[model samples]
Target: MHESLPISVFIIARDEADRIARAIDSVSDFADEVIVVDSGSRDDTIAVAESRGATVFRNDWAGYGPQKRFAEDACRNDWLFNLDADEAATPELVAEIRKLFAAGPPGTASFWQVRIKDVFAHESGPAPWAYGYNQIRLYDRRVGRFSESPVHDTVRPPAGARLGQLSAPMAHRSIRSIAFHVEKMNRYSTMQADDMASRGRRLARHRLLTEFPLAFLKAYLVRRYALYGWWGLVISTNFAYTRFLRLAKTYERELAARARSDSGAA
Candidate 1:
């Protein structure tokens, strides 16, 4: 009925007790192996994952890319499916993956996952894709690896690697609550700003002024978040705010560096 590929489903998490079970269960029906790598989660995250038939391991936090790479190395299969703690594959997606493996993974190198459908509890269910498309996550470990950035980590696929798109989309349950959204916004913006700092990037005043409004417009109009009504408005505002915050944090860091230099001269 389904195809199996000795595929290993690897998830790197920390304190994800509330949703890790669902993420793991989504793949249990099809994955050959499932592993969860924890990074000092104080909660019962470890216990929950273990109960869900996932082989659990504790590893120190080493940034997103490195931690994911660590899990990638631990996988026994050459094919790896990296899923976020909050992301789950729909049944149709599972069927697609089965079909892909049965037909053989894209000879081009690895598979790029479909832009996950963002789901919210308030709406009927998962919202339709209107606003943005996401990058790839699933790939063959042999030809691709995630970048080792301390903050901005993206998977690097080999040259000429055919990146095929999956027809089935992963469900992205991102907005847990307003409080959680704000916290996540702060954390991710800081991480992004830090990555920019590492690359010696500075914020331009023009960019600082334009980024938020442009981001809001793109999220609301280009991405078509407007179709969702109130939910769309919230997401657009959140996107715009996130853009502003990342630029603001980067600007703050730049100002701090300038102050330090001026003080040294004085």
Candidate 2:
């Protein structure tokens, strides 16, 4: 039976006390092993996870890519399900996952991309694409691992690997309030800027003014974000703005460096 296949659920978190238990509980039904890799959390996240029978490991803060990879490598099973502290696995998803392991997925199959249901405060709607939500969360661990990006890390499967989507959805509570969104935007924007800087790339003015606006329009209007109403508007606008801010910060740094170089010649 697919249920007999060794499956491990791995989570990487920090200061996620408020939400970690929900994540653990959601997967407890099907997960053969639940491993939590925490990056020096000061809160009760560790205790909560331990109480839920999760094997908690403490490591210093690493970038998202490295942190996730570390947790993946630690899993005892060859099949890994990577989840965030704020995300929960729906029963439908759990059943589908169990079925896949029973029949044994193809050798060429590397990952399953799960659909996400985004819930706003007291409201539920489809997530805008700009929210960067569609993600590959389940995979055969032997084929490949996640890339080592400081932010927005992606799983890279081996060559000729096939990707598929699951019918069940992963419930995501992304925007608890406007304040929650703001805080996340601020944190992620800084991480993105740092990532670009490390890569020796700067955002060009043309790209920012031309490309970003079009991207926003495609997400908010063309994607019919209006259907989600005001909350959708907030999601779209903030999503676009955060991207702009990340690139703009990178550009601003370049300008400062150029000015310093010119001043030195004078």
Candidate 3:
């Protein structure tokens, strides 16, 4: 018989000693178990998580989707909530989740999507909430799993699976510093390039030449990043640069491959 467990929260971590504790604590009262899968953190991430009553495990970093799926496999309950180390479940969200389980999860829906709100802490205290997007975090693992893409993976619930949305937003403490944000962009862009190359994808010449401006417009104007002032500009600019980097790296890979093939023919 399946245990009547309510929800199990899973988080994938890597050198997140500075932020993991808060993430774990946010869901501690409501979650049956909090699982943290670390990818060889050189910091005290594992220790901090364990101290907070999280079941910690070590897994070699393969890709974002793979690491998250690994945590899914470790979970004991069917109902799961996937959270990032920099994200926290708000009190309202936690209450809603508890209310969900009290009445029993709906058989109609496979997952619940939640809106995310970006927040920052200044010298004084927590800053005003900033804009954020939505993601499918609460789900039944039997019907949904994260897509296995190396970069920018998301939950892939079935076409017929009923999906619902929640009003309260999850708080995200994103981009702690400009340096941190830069490092993430560089890393994710390289991952995108490698994933594309391994799949035998040829670099799109048109995209290489024109994609950055389109990306910038989408992020800054359409996405309302302009509302945040200079930070919005910086974030939107980073988005554009990442798009360019991914295409540029993919182009380089194609060039190297063609050179190898030509040399062999000669």
Which candidate has the highest lDDT of all? 3
Where model 2 places Cα greater than 4 Å from the true spot, the runs are: 1-5, 103-108, 124-133
lDDT of 1 by residue, 150-260 (tens): 675578887787887876778877778888899999999999998898889877899888998999998999888888888789989998999999999999988899999
List the candidate 3 regions with Cα displacement exceeding 4 Å: 1-5, 120-129
The candidate maximizing TM-score is 1
Candidate 2 vs candidate 3: which has greater lDDT? 3
User: Per-model C-alpha lDDT, please?
Assistant: 0.83, 0.80, 0.85
TM-score of each: 0.93, 0.88, 0.90
Looking at candidate 1, the ten consecutive residues that score lowest on lDDT are 123-132
In candidate 1, how many clashes are counted? Answer: 3
Between candidates 2 and 3, name the one with more favorable TM-score. Answer: 3
- Residue lDDT tens for model 2, 115-153: 876655574433544233568899887887899876967
- Which stretches of model 1 miss by more than 4 angstroms? 1-4, 103-109, 130-132
Candidate 3 differs from the real structure by a C-alpha RMSD in angstroms, to one decimal, of 3.3
